[model samples]
Target: MKIGLYVLSIVCLLLIGCGDEKDSTPLVETTNKNQKPAITSKAIEDFDYTDYALSPESEEALANWEKYQELAIQIGYLKKADLSFFNGEIEDLKKFIDQFKTETPKQLLTNSIISRTAILETMLLKLNENLTLENIDDKLKLLSVRELLVAFSNLNYQINKKLESDIFNEIQPE
Candidate 1:
């Protein structure tokens, strides 16, 4: 009976010790109301294709420009979702959309980017109506916020691939 009690006490102490091990990382919440969440350490910058010497009328330039516009729309959606979560400010998101519009090349304004932008606009409107970080999952039915960010990264990769291919094609003698 004494041995049984000792074994049970040991088991109980082990269980108690295991329960005390909580995560040690400190949670640092952003105190500044105006600050945006640092989702990524790197900031997304606008790409200027003119450095590539891509002529406005060339077929490759047109294709790459179309891709660039699509990528910008994708990035816009991601930024909208992120800002909505962090700041819950509709005006900020609208301004982000405006930035994309102003940056797009005039000749490269294709139907693809326009249609995607319309969809993103509708999403922003819906988000504005029900602005809460808790409902972000429900708001973006097809993808969670993390997935949307991943999609944005993938779009960036696609743009890089297009640029690399364009450069390679230019180097090869026709």
Candidate 2:
């Protein structure tokens, strides 16, 4: 009976020890903060403007809109980088955001754009507040930030298509 109990206790201890092992990989690193990831040329190539039949003004606006999307991707990568290098990138991102805000025609402000702008602003505010690594809940916070960037990108694409349609309707002959 004593031998059986000892064997059962040893097995339980072994199971507990195995359960406690954790992977040692560091979640986020600060080393590559300065390097912006390459923006793939294919992203722009994939956009089919020819089929949209956009007016000249709409085409110009579409270019600017695409520029904003590219900048947003850069900003997303910056947001993922180390805290030390985030401020400079944030300033650059703000400037890009401001350019679209001020230069894009007021008539192009769809309800979707307004809602997305508000959400993006909120996410930026959260990011700024949690800039330090110590403050972040690694998985949850990082995932939220990533989701926000994706939402912004998808929303920006939709806004571009809507703008093209709106502009095309304005210029089309009745």
Candidate 3:
């Protein structure tokens, strides 16, 4: 009982010694009234939607642009060794579409977007479909991978037309 009491006392003293002064700043209270400018007005509220007609192609192009942006983000997680060769393909695709439309046509942009999207979709399908089970060499797998890589290479030709010079100038193989 004496040892237990001594231990308890020593713990209490140690804890007290470790305590620091508490912060004493008063919290500031803010009210939104008189704090900021008004952002909306009735003058901007009555715009009619029927007068604006976006072409299907333009919509498709926009969608494809967003998709490529997502792909670019995905590529950031990929190692340069794994994706270096294909990284420019999507960029080339963007350049191609950019050149073909120069401001993608309303009707044709949609078809182009669909076609571009299909390429990624097909590539993904091929990747996911391959089941390289236990060292049985897949000739089809090699062929598909080679084909997709080549396609990506061609796409990079356009996508990274400017950056390819930089990539080639930078890579130093050991």
Q: RMSD for each model, in Å, please?
A: 13.5, 11.2, 21.4
lDDT of 3 at 168: 72
For 33-108, candidate 2 gives per-residue lDDT tens digits of 5754232233323433332233455456756566455555565455445333233466664675676466655766
Candidate 1: residue 52 Cα off by (Å): 21
lDDT of 3 by residue, 41-107 (tens): 2211232222222234333444655544444443333312243323345555455434533443343
Clashes of 2: 0
lDDT (10s digit) by residue, model 1, range 1-174? 999999999999999888967889998875576755434222322221222222333435446455445544544655444343423577766776576556655643555545544555555445454435544543253233334344334434443455555567789575
> Best candidate per lDDT, number?
2
On TM-score, the stronger of 1 and 2 is 2
Q: TM-score of every model?
A: 0.36, 0.46, 0.28
Ranking by lDDT: 2, 1, 3
The worst-scoring run of ten residues by lDDT in candidate 3 lies at 37-46
Residue 103 of model 1 has an lDDT of 63
Q: All candidates' lDDT scores? A: 0.49, 0.57, 0.44
